[model samples]
Target: METNTQTDQVTNYVYIHVPFCLRKCSYCSFFSVNFSQEASSRFVKYLIKEINLFKQKYNIKPKTIYFGGGTPSLLTAAQINLIISQFDIAETEEITLECNPVNITNEFAKELTLTQINRISLGAQSFLDKELKVLGRLHKADEIRNAYKLLRAYRYNNISLDLIYGLPNQTKEDVEFSLDEIIKLEPEHISTYCLSLEKDVPLFSKIDQIPADEKVAEFYYLIRNKLISAEFEHYEISNFAKSGFESNHNLCYWNDKYYLGFGPSASGYLDFNSKTVCHPERSRRRDHLIRYNNSVNFEIYHKMLDEKKIMIDKIILNNDDHEKEYIFLGLRKAAGLNLEEFENKFKTDFTKKYDKVLHKFNNLLEINERTIKLKSEAYFISNEIFSEFM
Candidate 1:
């Protein structure tokens, strides 16, 4: 891991987590509690405290701010504005708020325009109400349409719609219907996720109902081709966007840049001079790069902040860890990983170090003079390919 010795530089990206939802989705595994006015108000106060604590530690001039959540839309426009006021944001900066369709009322959209928020990511998981019911979403199919119209009426040009594929008993026509609606709406960006039945999620009980692996792959390719044909760039594994509208905040993550995360369960990565030793067995030498996660328990989070103590699990990254992360994270982008840049960063020849794994997955990967990437057709099995590096 390279040491960033400069202490004057500002961390330009920030992620604020709002961990309260009206209802937890059946497939969600993220940390969130049922929404309550009193609890949410209290959470906001503590969230501001957490932000202030970090402000004292780093010089943060945010270029991109992302409010992700249990449902960020649940926050009042004033609450959202209070959070944004903490940063020195420019008009050109991209500030995105993820919203549940049901929460985007006309009045809410009007108030949002008064804030610094420039982008909206609407959670429209499916165009069919039946699928939404199956996934335990609070809104109906019509609400998604109404929400988009409402946002547009308030002059929100940068909007991203989310879609989920490979639902139980989902068919080709089902996907086509959803795709047709999405294309017609012409959102500035689109994110598509394939349903994964994690054991901890309520949806896991119906694991057998999921489509076969082969069918899921077909759905993936179908989505890719449709979005591409609609003039959207397939920029990342699960994201597509119109040119110049690709998510700058998400791009920061994929490009391996430093970012700050605030609120409970939020995680952050930074490169700085520190005396912390990650591997005491190897040497007592300081590690410069570290990733830390705030406590998931809300009570502990508030208590630590109240006591002016940082409650985080921190991991110092060594060269090997950094190299693996760079490969996996960089490969998630459609542009792939640049071999020259990798060698420059790690002081290792890419071809020489992983020659065996490279040859093993030769046909699935695209290797050129300067870059290496998975072929588009092989994206469905990217996890299997990434495991070789692990």
Candidate 2:
């Protein structure tokens, strides 16, 4: 909320969404369509147009670029290059592409390296075949192993393995068994997420079959301790990484920095203050914090962009909304919030602003004059603590 013009200028991260999949996962709620060469080609063209529109509007020079999916690996190397070529990316920008195991091959990896993509996030949900089937994953446990070896053989050192826990009938031992493989594999980063049976997803039909909340909390601690013991830093709620391997793109989000997201179902945020001041010496006439989303309907998106309609829903955040998001997102990081930074940004005394809530949850949150963080034991109940800020 206290994000001034200078903060906006420094937060130019980019996210490109490719929403096509061969099959849908039972737990997913993201907008995506079935793959077709003709449809994908058409979508790519529209995507380029959308990217250009943002580039023109914001004049952004990106610090990091994230290619997220419906399996970004499905696109040919040539297609990848075509999209990236349009961007004014830094030479050392962290270009990340999320991939599926079955889509990775040694030949494909070589071609992919040519695109200058430095980070590859392999979707290795679980090592147990039974659990994989429960989540409706396309590849088997063996394919995860094959994909890692293939990428390594091609010299892709900065790889991140994504894992899921708290599935139906999952246990602490099962989580430990999977971590054995993850630890042995020794990825530069590890992202472990708890399964959510979102409404309307196929898995929601059997929500009763999933583990209890208590069980899921146990699984959370199990994996947290595993990564810590293996010497991986728990940098975020669901992310662990070796030193210097934390995701720069994702860090932008938790730190409440401005980022531009392109493609259908993608969301973006921007903040600035107009220089038209009533008093010549004073800062800003007014601060504008805008968040926008493109149309999720693929057909509608294409028609709008092609005709220059650009069906984007834009919302201007009020002071309350911005301040709430600032605290909420900042608390998710492992190093936690700096008291001085928070106070300086918002032009407020941090402890004084949320005195009641901080006092109420004092046992769960560790607060000092300099910083504030959730205690390790209270991480599972973070939502409840964050709600007080709301």
Candidate 3:
């Protein structure tokens, strides 16, 4: 990490990545190794060391902590407590852990609640058994509901359900069935993602087997309308939340707040304290923003953590690119870009700066005195709109 100093403004957000999985889903691309008692124990020790080293290095007090993973639920309750005890967090901090159905147990859930894990984001990809099989999930469909009941039994009310649409051989009926099941469970948050077949994943070669582009578009629209009717706010492009339930941890990223990341294969963006070049919504003391990535290889990560000699891949952003990124990220939110905030931060006239691109997307984007956002009808093509900023 780049060395910097400030009397105030220490990094206030933290993410710890756990890269161990029992089985890597066929469509998944996250880094991971097989889970085992010995390996997991060592990983926990190294993570504790890594977190302490960075905490001392940066003097951070985390306001929100997310335990993201190949499968964070793989950790035993004792291990979770051991790692979380290292952090200096507030009493009201949002501590979230990820889980999959196969790994959840009623006893484990009870133990987890005792460790201060106030939130759970379950990877219940689909509520349909056939779809689960196609997605290579190890758990059966009924287990999703069972796991939800278990979490509720442990008083984890702030739960998020993760689902995927645009799947191979998926139908509109399937989409409705899944959403109906989700509404019945009544989680505080819903994150629906389109299936993208990236290179190297097992699903890439069989793209031809999936739903057509138009069909996927319909699925996206249906989900948006249904989720809205269910009283969930489409706060971000891929995320919906009940009122007052938006994810603070993820909002930090979209809002351009500085954060720290730990563990192998994890990434962080810190620094860049300065007034926005064109907009005045932000004023700060950051000099430059740098994004850094830790070593993805496990052995190298452990060695560095043990010796306190970690190396990172760094990219320092320049002013123009940074301004562009601010636009790019802000546009991904359902609340859209605040025009006055944009102009003030970048110190440019919004209407005049990119008139051509704005004109090109006039119909697809909604612009008003207070905001500029993608029209709900145009959200399925948000990627195309995002590329204009890129």
- The lDDT values for all models are 0.89, 0.83, 0.83
Global CA lDDT computed for model 2: 0.83
Q: What does the lDDT read for residue 75 in candidate 1?
A: 95
Model 2: per-residue lDDT, tens digit, 33-110?
898888878878998997776554455788889989777888889889998888877643799999999889888988
User: Which RMSD values do the candidates have, in order?
Assistant: 3.1, 4.0, 4.0
What lDDT is obtained when candidate 3 is compared to the true structure?
0.83
- Structural similarity to truth (TM-score) of each candidate: 0.95, 0.93, 0.92
lDDT of 2 at 290: 70
Instruction: Output the lDDT of residue 3, model 1.
Output: 26
Model 2 residue 60 CA deviation in Å = 1.7
Error of 2 at 209 (Å): 1.8
Error of 3 at 258 (Å): 1.0
Compare the candidates by TM-score and give the number of the best one. 1
Better of 1 and 3 by lDDT: 1
Residues 218-274 of candidate 1: C-alpha lDDT, one tens digit per residue: 999999999999999999999999999999999999999999899889999887433
lDDT of candidate 3 at residue 389, scale 0 to 100: 67
